[model samples]
Target: MKLFPYKPRRYQEEIVQTIFDCLKDRKHLIMEAPAGSGKTICALVACLSFVSENDKGIIYLTRTNSQQKQAIQELKRIAEKLDLKAVSIQGRTNTCLLIDAIPSLKEKNMSNEDVARLCAARKKRSLEAMRGKEEWNRCIFFENFLLIKNELKFDRVVAAEELVEYGRKYKICAYEMNKMLAKKADIIIAPYIYIFDEFLREKFSMLYS
Candidate 1:
């Protein structure tokens, strides 16, 4: 099967085949390739092939948003050639509508955890207010999120920027939308910290684990 858009050089083909073999044999692999060697696409196509055959999914971990976006772009190209779907998820600070809406949080030198805590507090207050009223006074985006959560499609590659746009256009929380989509995505691209950061890891354990 043709996995890449362009012709794979000899070394790239070798790496892809090796990855396929290792996955098929259920063996661990440690490969080292130089920069700009097409390692991203090679690994992507190889793992996608393995998942297609096994009826499983792929979780790709990177270190930054740029890396995640790069992978998503490559996945999008591959999707043009194959029927594949992928999603790129960043931390709450990057995708959270609540935090983004709060001007204080944007200007203050707050960590992601701190921003998350403040956002959670705001949400809690909004939920409490709902006990007396019929309408939601909390984050409108989050309330609207529940309405369209089930209708989201994961049948195609969605980059972080595109996901945020959908959320904004639909009046939902982008971060929450990503979490919902992650469950159904054929491939999930996230930061490496999601696996090691205690709080973040616990939050995504259900989807990733």
Candidate 2:
């Protein structure tokens, strides 16, 4: 109905119904469908419908950036019919400019956890510098973020890449910007690792907690 953005395809109605039922009943669901069977939109519509009435939120996890981008495209379509805000986030390894900018950091081939630790250290320094600490070198990107964070306004559906570009243009930190966006979003699209990896999961959960 109103939640479904497109006319139902073959078996699409059944899939959506099953998903909505499972969600309402607080049970797990698994769906098997062929390529181009419209699974993404069906799942979004089902989840959106459930959460719209239940006053819950949706966290859509994907394994790759392409998958995350596709999910964001579908969310944009749904947002046309439904008033909602959606954001996609990538891990610090992907979104952090420092990793790309600094040849030393790039040469180190740091893991996501490594990048996160570096980010935390830099953020602390940035905050300290803001408060008149002169010895510690500030993260310029994070410093710019703190300066303009309150004035930033995101679109209804924001992709991680878009945020990255915006951060590059504004000279801010994209990873941190997405974290802020996640707090106000009705639907958050992120990598599956954010939930499957213990360290990332705890950090991701803190945004909601």
Per-residue lDDT of candidate 1, residues 96-137 (tens digit): 776567687678867877867866876776666656654343
The TM-score of candidate 1 is 0.86
In TM-score terms, candidate 2 sits at 0.94
| Cα distance off (Å), candidate 1, residue 196 | 2.6
lDDT of 2 by residue, 64-152 (tens): 88998999998988889999999998878888986777788899989876887898888898888899978464588888988989999
Task: Tell me each candidate's TM-score.
Answer: 0.86, 0.94
lDDT of 1: 0.80
